[model samples]
Target: MTVHVLEPACDWRAADVADETRWTLELSPADIAELEAALACAKARAADLLDVTRDDFPLPSLAPRLVEIEAQLIDGCGFARIRGLPVERYSDDDAALIYWGIGMHLGKPWPQNKHGHLLGDVTDHGKSGADSTSRGYELGGVALPYHSDGSDLVGLMCLRKAMSGGISTVANALAIHNELVRTRPDLAALLYEPQPYDYRGEEPKGGEPFYSMPVFTEHAGRLFVRYIRPYIEASQRHPDAPRLHPKAREAFDLVDAVCADPAFNVYMDLEPGDMQFVNNYHVLHARTAYEDWPERNRKRHLKRLWLETARLTDRPEKFRNFSSHWAQKRTKSELKLDA
Candidate 1:
């Protein structure tokens, strides 16, 4: 197998971005005012959350900045956080509206789950981590391994934080891939082949329980990755799924090790009202196990959005979401568990 060294704009290490200010954008007072006005406008129109569009929630002063953020997501660092949203002043519904509006300006909303949820909640649903049907975002108090989602970008808005832990970590998958090419081209080449991924019980009726896609794909000189360690491991449960080659297993372990290394990843402790966005193709994101607060209102909760970015015009057929069945039912996921 022939492997080539390819470098992209997002191939930076942790040391290269040691300054938090480089990736963190703090909302200005003027920006906050614009957001408030937009929230009020949307509320006055009595627009449903799904019905709200970018024009309905105008951010005249902040829209240009969001355009820059969109570019950064596709062409630069591949991850960013916007801080200083005074969540204490707004109700939960109002805060969600603000997040939805901001997401509209960035990209078109994509359904996150099989339920066709354009909007989603990231909170504990009393799901057991050991359950094969459980998704990482549906459970709490467990570390989520680094993996890419099924979209051009993934956004999360923090409504509340955990009592302890739950730090968000993002690693540069481009850097990891390039490193593999340089050090172990054999493993890297192996990853470019098709690997089976379990659907976690969400496969369409009578459809295969597992689907196959390459872990690494290069198109138009850009690298794209889709990796879910648990899903890959769980695919073994389906006897018909392709068996993992021994070298493929070694390659998967190396990817995980590189992501966990301090030199390759950066950790962020998000506060209430902070928003984070990552390029799903270039970055692998994860969360640490967290302890929730005793009070029901204080438990960790985040609103999620999967976005189809306009900047990314083309993709490998395998990366495109071909699950039309997901669109058959459109509803938001608002599951909550008793504290």
Candidate 2:
């Protein structure tokens, strides 16, 4: 693998507002009005899409008009917020709708919603809940390490945070990539090799427990990244999985070095009503460990969506399934795994 460095061009907007990386663009009255209109229309939409009969789609469908609104917001700020909750909030459908709708705007639908996933208090089979951590020392409320997921983009809405902690973090993948190329060419080359990744128990039917891919991939001379260290670590549990070569370990260390620096990252404390969408291939993000108050109902809960975005970066053909474009056009929750 060849190391290549491409520094960002000077831009007043990108530079002027460069503190800690959490860019906050206050919405204008028009933006807020637009949001209210979309929210109203979404509530009016009734697609039996979320009905169980439509297996892949497990959430109500928002009208095209509302979806357009979400796209505009994503293009401008990479995130948006929508307020108001259902009066009869019996299920998590409403939350699902909001997450899915925004994801549609960002990219293609990658049918995965960690369905009814429980964090601290879960009592279901296939439990990968908060128990796996040693001594019950869950990384709750601690700033989670920065990593990317297996999608073009990820949508997260701050449903509710704990009384304290749960801050979000972001790091520009491009910055980190460029740094590796400039400072450690040998390490950068190792990123081209396949690195095993755990499914976190989410995979297609009869699929292996883990799969392998480079945490760092480059296509068309551009960077395409997917890194989740914890999941990568977990994949080690499978005996058949390949071990990281020394070169891969060196690359990981170099990546870590760049992430540890503020020059490549931005941190933010998401406020209520704030929703964020990230370019998963270009950004690495994480959350700080949080404290929850079950007795008082203050728990840190976030709705997550995996999106296949309209914008296509150059990538190896394997990553792009033939139906990827079509998948982007469909409504969210249309693709569901048994999980």
User: Using lDDT as the measure, which candidate wins?
Assistant: 1
- Local lDDT at 131 for model 1: 94
Give the Cα-based TM-score of candidate 1 against the true structure.
0.96
Best by TM-score: 1
Off by over 4 Å in 1: 321-323, 336-339
- lDDT accuracy of residue 331 in candidate 1: 71
Encode model 2's per-residue lDDT on 1-339: one tens digit a residue.
566774243111223336423344344455544444554456565453232122232223333433543443333323333433321232345545544444554455554323322111211122233433221112344456778755666666655666777777776666677666777777776776788987755444577877788866767755677787777777788898898677776677677767766666666777654566666656777766666655433455555656665556455764663322223333333222112
The number of residue pairs in model 1 that clash at the backbone is 0
lDDT of 1: 0.89
> What TM-score does candidate 2 reach?
0.71
Residues 1-339, candidate 1, lDDT per residue (tens digit)? 687766556789999989988888899898899999999998887658888889999999899989999998889889999999998788777888999999999998887778899899898878997899999888988989999998889999999999999999999999999999999999999999999999999888999998998999999888889999899999999999999999999999999999999999999999999999999988999999999998878899999999888888887775565345677776776554322
